[model samples]
Target: MLLPSRPAPVLALALLLPPLAAAAQTPMTATEFEAYATGKTLTYAQGGTIFGTEQYLPNRRVRWAFTAQECQEGHWYEADSQICFVYESESDPQCWAFWQEGGRLKARFAGDPDGTELTEVEQSKTPLACAGPDVGV
Candidate 1:
């Protein structure tokens, strides 16, 4: 006796399953992730991963060193939290940077004038900073 064959629809779905799953697993948008990052300070957990510091100015301007790991991986607010900026680590001298404007998140690297678009990650409580001055005001 011959065994029954799989349905054509099932076979088609099996072929498309992997790509569909991958699309669903795409990384969270900058906006989505930024919500979790704002109003907080980020620093390197280890000394050598990247080294940098953030200086909080009295005028609400945060001066940062992009070369430093903390600055490169860190996120901060500008203009009294009117805008949020993030420095994502990268292999080249250029790194991923993003900011929020008009209820949207825009991203760019280095000095690129044309920026990429981003989606916001779900909001999450800011992570605690262990190395810097207490931000607990």
Candidate 2:
């Protein structure tokens, strides 16, 4: 005769542990939000290194790097969209997107091979000078 196994309790404990740990964490602050927002240049390193610099505007919105090919005009955003940047593609106009998750900045390129990815670079908190009439937070 074979001995009975006791693995059911161990399996149940493993399944229930992570969710309990996650629920104990606190939400991030506004200052923390801004720091993560203007963190660093998001890059694609697979093919050739394509760099995109990001900065917080005076209006609390974010701006990204502009290039002649991928990004045009260096202005990036249009006034009518209220701050959303447009991503251009050969097939159709793609929406340039960004958001914060788990206190990190994430970006995505539309119609591109890669999906949204977390930036590996650390964010710095050095204050930037305001250029126009807009106010700071």
Per-residue lDDT of model 2, residues 62-120, tens digit only: 43432222222122332322223432222233333344556554433333332322232
lDDT of 1 by residue, 1-137 (tens): 00012211223333544544422332335344444344433331111232223333333233344222233243334332133444344322323344444443333222333222223322223433233343456
lDDT of each: 0.33, 0.35
Clashes of 1: 6
**Top candidate, metric lDDT:** 2
Q: Highest TM-score: which candidate? A: 2
TM-scores for every predicted model: 0.25, 0.34
Note the clash tally of each candidate: 6, 0
